[model samples]
Target chain A: MDTTQLLKGVLDLAVLAVVADEDGYGYDVVRRLRAAGIEEVGDASVYGTLRRLYSSGALTSYVVPSDEGPHRKYYGINAQGRAMLGAQRKDWDEFAGTMARLLGTEGGA
Target chain B: MSIVDDAIAQDVRTYAAQVRAALADLGPEHVDDLTDGLEANLADALADDRRAHRGTLADEFGAPADYAAELRAAAGLAPGSGGQRTGGAVDRALRQLVGSVRDIEGTTLARLRATRWFPGVEDLLVALRPAWWVLRGWALAHLLLQMVGAEQGAFWLPSSSGGWVLLLLAVVASAQWGRGEWRTGPRWGRVLRFASGVLALAAAILLLTLPQAHRDDVARAQGWGDRPVEDGVVVAGERAFNLFVYDADGRPVEGAQVFDQAGRPVTTEPYGGDRWRQQEYWPDGAGDPLFHVGVPGPNGETRWNVFPLHSVPGWAWADSGAPLDVTDEDVRGEVLAPSWPFAAAAAVVPWRTGPEATLPAPAGASTPGATPSAEAVPPSDAPPATDGSAVPEPEPAVP
Candidate 1:
């Protein structure tokens, strides 16, 4: 199955989780999500998710000046983001267990 | 930094600009909010790609347009159309029309930008946008001036100081509008943008046709040189076809040349009002030779200044252009004579035929020759000739 199609349903939750674990800039978050096995997640989608979270007050951003090339904008998850992530996590776990049981792989994995 | 790094930065900036352009229909502030850190994000992504030994960003993600769409969707913004579909039929139709126009415009711009030189040209155009704004304002001012029927002065410039003030205000307003300083709601902003487009088109058309209008005015002004005062003599507010001269005896004088106060020959040649009659006079002739043909002068030039210029009736001339001898005996066609006002004007000085009957040195510059044979001389008691055949006593001796 294409993970990209699956990633769209939980991109917001994934971005929030990644940011809560460790506050990071745009590319850093994208790299972290890829390393966590969501390799098909696009850069633009992650960046857009971060912006949306910031706009909705679930995340806060600050500018970090860099000596490399340009200034980097860093985003950190807030309490609202963490609470939303907790709720989505519970729902995902329940949904995954129901699917696993239906497929008769409940005890195999 | 190395030149390679500079090239990468430039590529990233170009890509970011393309993304922003895809979302341009959104308000400038909204677009800014969406694409604020776009360049830095793209640069970071490119650096990561280089370290990981991946292909270009385009290969990894997608085209800029698709990226912008994904961004817009993920950010909880509307699609590129941006119009909500919760309206009535008319609103839907209007939105459809606007969307179609936007689609065509975007497609055409994209095609143009794909050309080799178009990006540089677009850069130049973007740099010249302020100048265009000022010109748009000037055009709007001229349009208003024309609408109010107070159009004056030069074509590209306003006429008066007040006009200049209006132009200045319009330009400032236009520049402010271009810079997004005068903010409006979405609907009103769209309406104003459409109105400005129409006004700009009208101004371009006006500017293109200005030279033709100016030419017409110049032609009309120059036409004043040849006027009625010089064309045909008007007497008592009526067009006088022929001028008759009389001697001291109150007898009709033949072949008397007339001139104005300035020694210009006074002729009735130009008053051929009926083109059909002129065609009858000289059917296939090119020039107005018949117009100036009357009695011969000393210099042998066809002078029209001869008084009471004799003319054979139009039908008297054959197809060969020669006047046929049409006397009272052989009147084949109708001999329509000119409308003569009087048979003989009362002479100012009475005739003293015995000795000192000195003639006023012939009126015009052309020297008078021997008297012409009187084919249709007006009698003393003759009434004003209305139509055909004024000569009651036609000389059979005339050939």
Candidate 2:
């Protein structure tokens, strides 16, 4: 199966986790995700997720001027986003354990 | 910015605009929310793409249209939702129809691709697309000319200079449109699709009618159709059914074989008129007859070329509905001939010499004069041409 298919279900959580670490502009967040090995993450998908999170009040946005190009819009995780991310992380751990157990690949189950 | 950076910046702006245009059906707030920082995002991405020596903006991000679709999906927005509130019921229905038709087309294409030889067929169809574009343009021009009553039956060539210009412009425009040189909004895109469907139907109709129209043109050029065919001899624009030939002594001749100067037999079948069959003839008081029948030749061929053709009173055969046999002795009766218009026509004497042409005189007159004397009139006391005693005996069979 394509990894991109796997990425879609967790893209919102991934975006929230990335912003929760530190404030980053759109491209900055995408670069961090790629460096963290989620290389198949699409640029538009990350941008859209950021916009959706900001609109839903889970993320806050602010403009940061740059001399190189247009002003960059940066996103940061708020309290709502951190709470959501904590719950999602716990859910992910449980799901990963269940999958590993089912596939008989966990170290000690 | 440096010149190269400026060019990159321009590219970023153009790409951002394309993405925005793709999302044009969304409400203003929705579109603004989606595309607020698109240019800055695109600029940073393109710079990295350039540094990495990757493909162009489209290669890095896919087409702007596809990118917009992904954005809409990822943002949890339904496709075409934002534009629904602005459209009327009919517009929405039409949009649904277009979407359904597109879905069906995609499904059909997918099914066809599964067949072994369909790929080759599809390739052939793709190769013929340009030809179809040209033909549809020509068909549109043909329809326009036909509406204005200026068509002259040629498929490839228009009749007038104005038509030629129009055809050229339409073909160029159609080819450009096929090549996707012009950008259209979502609504205009649907309208263009509808127009193309209508043009396809018109092209099919023109294909069927072109051959028939060509045949009609050929018939008109050769002057053969549209008039009833006239057979046999025509005198003063009226068909002469049977010839009435009179001897110099005013006796009506029967069974005279007439011919033209070229010795071609002048067959007097009189296929042009039905009035002769409906006319009443006296038959010289030999009782009225049911119908008339022409006498057959010795070889049993009805001799149409025979003058004052010998006709007899006849009845139809009970079994076949054909005229009663004239050879039968019991059925043979008095020959029914039409009454002659003159008893005895006046005779004329030929003049030997004249500076100016002088008219012939009556045979009894001494001088050749133009004026008619009492003797020049036809004699009323002479025997009628239709008299029963004047009937001649049948000549020896010539077959």
Candidate 3:
């Protein structure tokens, strides 16, 4: 798959994981994603995904008004989102271990 | 100077606007930076394309839908199904509808804004800012004079027309103020200045023509009835009475009545006319009376009048059985014969030129069946004249 497509599939997991640690506004999420080496992530896409996830009951949002500009909506993962993250992590570990074994690497196994 | 460059710039602007609209659902915090970056990139791309003498902007930038898709992807949302999106047709139709509605609304707004007084007095202030201090002083003085009721005082004085003169002065001042181009210095401006001057003059004239009223005044005046009376005679058959009357201004009067010889009014109320009431009446009523009469004018002119009923099918004029002592003079003066279809169909028997002509018809002579010779010809072979100019030749000068 293209890096963009691969990146898209993991974005939800990344967002939940980031907000899993601390709730963040759209810009904060974008900054964290960029810092984490996801250079292809766009500010708009992160916000849209955050809203979608929140609407799908994985995340909840709260408004924090700023004197500098408009109010900011912050997102944090809910119980269902945390459970989804745990399942994704487990699936990733299993896949990585299987790939290591197929590659005949002790570290992978 | 380059068409390509201009087109590219326009495309950039248009694309930017579209992007703005599409991303409006996204909160400003989320999309503002991305949208700004996109606009900058789009502009640069268009500029670069123009420099390279590339193909059309549409070809260069790709299809708008594809661009929107790319933007949506970059924004990190799930990509829409590349497969046939349900409601795609409906969505396209709705977008077109919204676009057309927006275009119409925009045009209407532009037209309305182009009218005077839009952008308003602030624009006037900006344009006149150079002479602001002097104009302000003058305005203050003018208002002070007005506050003391100078206009009313001038009206009561011997020089009663001073108010008009003052108005003319104000108009001249306004024209002069509009004449000064201000920022560009006092040079002859374009035709717009002249137009403004003309408008000011028109406003002055309108003000002068307005009736001045006093709040203290309580009395008022009114006019009484001055309607005219017209008379006519219809000899049965179908007839159409077209009443013509004008007001003092020679305007057509509306809503006049036609009365039968028995003093019975036979016309639809609410007739229309400029000066006198005009109406088309049919003699469909019973007991064919003598002459049909219309109300007389204030000038005592015969108010009600009728003409010989035309013989045309479906054509009926207001009528009365009253025997009119109509000589060639009466027919020549007011009541002309009905034209065409009516003339060809009605049996018009001219009364004999003698004492019998002046005498009332014998009893029962007004009976309908007694006048069979006067029956309007049904399907007469009268060819409708072509030029409408061929006069009927005199009947061989009867010996």
Candidate 4:
């Protein structure tokens, strides 16, 4: 599969995973996504998705002003987001195991 | 400024307005920080986009309203689409009305600033002290002109003009004064002074043009007259035509047209009646409803209507009869019958009669038509001319 499509499939999972550890603002989330090897995620798209997820009760947000630049609006995963992330991780692992079994290869797992 | 910077600023303002609108239910206090934060982020993103040579920040991020809607949705606010009728309609109407009024006022003020007399007045007032002195002097000169029949024996006082001149002078003086004593007054004083200067300029134009507007009324009352010719042919060369008509006061009259030697209606369509007043000229093919008139020019053959008076010596009235081949000299012999109203309406039109009997003396004996200087005496006591008859008496010495 193309890397873009692969990245799109995993974006929500990646975002939930990042905020699961620590809250982050729009650009900060973009930086974390890049550091985690998902370079295709746009800044605005991340911010927009973060907002959408928060509105859906998957995440919560609070604003903190920065001395170096404009204030940061940080988002953290709530109980709902964590539960969704855990379910998605389990589904991905099971799917990988099934593909490995069908391919009959050690690397496919 | 760079186009990107301008676009960014515009986007920021638009985003701010949308966010504020969406957050109306949340109250200003709750939304102010959020909107500010969003704007700051948007600005930074746009700057980054510019640095990266991206086409438009808008394309990268969706429209500001969309972004605001997303934010509002996240905040658990009602979607924007559902609240179209409640307060939004009223706000939109009010904004539209205000925007239209502002557009008209701004256009009018801009046209006023572009005129020559405004700058001349500014330069005159700047060299003078007690700025009121310059204003009072113009007022007095106008009063004296009104008292005399000099301006066609008609009172020509535009109070708005004097008010504007005084205003401009004060603003200029205040700026100068503030520069010397900046520590005393607040910074807002300078802004007020700048605004005052702009208003003064607008007022000056209103004053000058308003008076001339009266003259236009008088000219219109003298309705244009036409001379019936059995047959007239306009040649390829220049020709002059004259006619006597009564001015219909200031009311606009239908303009006349000219015909070719063959009587193939050469004049362009008549304009300047109730339907439309002013028409713009465009050199390119962009002109709307192109108007064409027959006139011989340097380029073999071309059509032009409303040639400047200086270029074309006389005016042409539309002729309905057959075209007769006539030279400029031949056309000179034709006598124009004056409209009966032109001869009889003298009683009603002030210019038709002699200067009004109550003419006033020149303020402080300055020669009439000399263009009053800044030092001229402030003729405060002279009462403003009320009626058309109270023309100020022209100084006998005015050359």
Candidate 5:
């Protein structure tokens, strides 16, 4: 089963979760997502999510010029973003738990 | 940078520009942020020591408009083809036109840079930007002045006409003092400003070349003589072509330039001056009749508007040759026609001086720039009716 559709639904959750732990710029967020094993994550999608969250008052953003590369706009999760991240994490946990049980892999079958 | 690296950098910039063009209708702030991000990523992608020199960033990221669409989506904006497709009917049409034009211009520019047909077009356009920018600035200034009902300009500049003097002054100022910003060395701001200063010079030249009067000034400066024909008449073969001014019948009766049936300027050249058989500009071309004459169009601008000259008449108009034995009827029937394929394809039927006319003998039918020893057909007498037939001479001196 393709995880792309699933990732799209929880992109907001995933972006907030990543930024909640530590602030990151657009490309940095993409790199972090890839490192976290979400290979399907697109760089542009992370950027869009950051912007959307910032516009909705769920994230704080700032610009920092880099000597090594182009200037970056860093996005940090705020109170509202943290709250939404927690709620979505709980929802995803419950859903995943139900799905796992439905699969009946109790003894590593 | 290596040539390949430089080339890739240019391609990247072009891609970024395409993205910018697609997002043009969006507020500048939004567009800027997105483009900035895109550029930063591009720099990282190109500069990071890992990726090999391989496919273009465009191939990886897709086309510019597609990338822009993705960027817009990432920014939580509507899809490019949806609510954000642009405004009303007129707006949509304009956007489509702009999009197509931008795509065409950008792709063609990139592809043509290395081609013989438009070599150096890319660099030339880039260098021409300063002139373009300065002119645009002055034009804006004029528009604003008109809006405020200012009839006179502040300096010697005109409210409407003489903004080029203003542009030249600004370019001179920039070249002189624009380096002040760069005195501190090549920071982003200093380097950018330094680059802009280079355009000021280009702008000055662009301004200088903008008008017909200025073009004439350039010609005079180059000592090509502003106008060659006197009183609109050129005495090529004892008969004159009144090219510039009108005759008594209020028509251009004579000119060194001859037109084909389709009104194409026939080619000609003078043998005495410059390089014999070398093409020269119109107005200046009468002296060297080997080249077709160039003229300013109905608009004051000079386009490549040389009427294609038939090679035979062209040669005759040369200093060493005689006038074509043609009448007013021949001019209407052959030279004034709307197309020239027939005129070009038809056999060299010698102009009829009477009911019985003979084609000029090959020995006497030599082009003006041809050997002077070759006898030329006289203007008044028809060639002797040898064999009572038209002689088919080998066509030469014409492509």
Candidate 6:
């Protein structure tokens, strides 16, 4: 199954989690997501997700002038983003638990 | 060396532009936001450990529109096809127009460069840009003049009050561009800049195709174009023929007004009423339905044979009972009569004589005993007197 569909639902969560720990620019977020083993994440998708989240007030951003290239737009999760992330995490954990029981993973050797 | 570098620079620029176009209609701010650092990022990627990447850069990005769609979806924005941005139909259409113009200019320029073996054409075209700028201003002024109701179809620069106004305005516009910048305030400044570009393009087209081929009243008056015989074919440079006018009675009608088939005076010469021109005789009295009188060349003694202009009903009309009606109040004929006399009469409907006919015996031979009978009228419009007699005495014009 193409996890791209699955990843679409969790992208908000994934992007917020990556930036929650430290502010990162668009491509930097992509690099991190790939580093975390989400190989299916497209570079453009990550950039757009960052923009959407920032415009929604879930992420705050500032431009850092660059000597090497274009000034980078760095994004960090704000209080609103953190609050939403906490809520989403709760719902995901509950859903995972129920799925795990149905799939026989609860006590399977 | 620089040409190759320019080609590369142009390639990169074209790619970036394609990307920008894909994002058009999505909203300018949104498009810019997505593409802000894309070029710089691309430069970096290309620089990283060269030789690591294979194939063309386009292969990596795929089609720009598809890429844009992906970005739009990821950003939670609606697709352009969904009509979210269709409210800017004008804006979208303008973008497309500009795009096409740019594409045409680019391809044409590229083709020109590629064919540089044509010897100076490529470099010459590039060097002509400055000249095009000047022409642009001139063309722009002409367009503005016409828009404000200056005469249309006068391809030459304006000589009227409006033309002077255009010159003055151009000087003012140039004056405003000091130190390589426009001095006008922002609003008017932008208007001038845009007009300058549009006018320049328009001027480019005008200069390329309009001016040289365009004929003006001045040129026509100067006998620069199709002229009528009534205009007396103003012998401007090297005159070919001299026209002498006469009445239906073959009496030398000096100063008889010449007219075109439409009855327009070929010249403003005092002979005719109002003239199509002031002084110069229109060449060959350019008009349909003309007439010509032919006298056999030096080969034989022949009187003038008049033929109606073939343009009338056709050449056959000249052979009709009255190939032309010369005796009317006004007969407009433009013709190249054969044996075109350097000095001859302009009588209507010159008479035709068979090729075997010889000139009438010289009229000076007439004696009282001959009684110049009923056959005295010459069969042709040419007065029988080859010696330039004032008139032909009889119907046959000869005994």
Candidate that scores best on TM-score: 1
Best by lDDT: 2
**Residue A34 of model 4, lDDT score:** 73
lDDT of 3 by residue, B1-399 (tens): 479756766777787677655554443322342353454445544443223335664565555555555556644543332222334677668645644564464345334444676536534644564454333333433443456666432222113355445544654565455444232211133244444445545445433543353222212221123334333323364333433333344332232233454445344223322123433333345232112223323333332322112121111222442222222233324332222221122234545568556545556554322333222221122233233433432211111
Better of 2 and 6 by TM-score: 2
| Range of the 10 consecutive residues with the lowest summed lDDT in candidate 2 chain A | A55-64
**Model 1 misplaced stretches (Cα beyond 4 Å):** A1-109, B1-86, B107-111, B152-154, B160-162, B225-229, B232-371, B381-399
Cα-based lDDT for every prediction:
0.65, 0.66, 0.46, 0.47, 0.51, 0.55
Candidate 3 backbone overlaps, count: 57
Number of the candidate with higher DockQ, 1 or 3? 1
Once fitted onto the true fold, the runs of candidate 3 whose alpha carbons sit more than 4 angstroms away are A105-109, B1-17, B20-399
TM-score computed on alpha carbons, candidate 6:
0.35
Residue by residue across A4-103, what tens digits does model 1's lDDT show?
8998999988999898898788889988998898888778788888878876657767666679767677776655566689999999999988997978
Instruction: Give the range where candidate 4 chain B is weakest over 10 consecutive residues by summed lDDT.
Output: B306-315
Q: Which one wins by lDDT: 1 or 2?
A: 2
Cα distance off (Å), candidate 6, residue A74: 1.0
RMSD of each: 17.9, 22.8, 28.5, 31.7, 28.3, 22.9
For model 6, how does the per-residue alpha-carbon lDDT over A9-97 read when each residue is reduced to its tens digit? Answer: 99999999999878787767776787788878766788788877875557766656678545766676655677778998888889878
Q: Each model's DockQ?
A: 0.16, 0.16, 0.04, 0.05, 0.17, 0.14
* Candidate 6 lDDT (Cα, 0 to 1): 0.55
Count: clashes, candidate 2? 0
Predicted structure 1: lDDT: 0.65
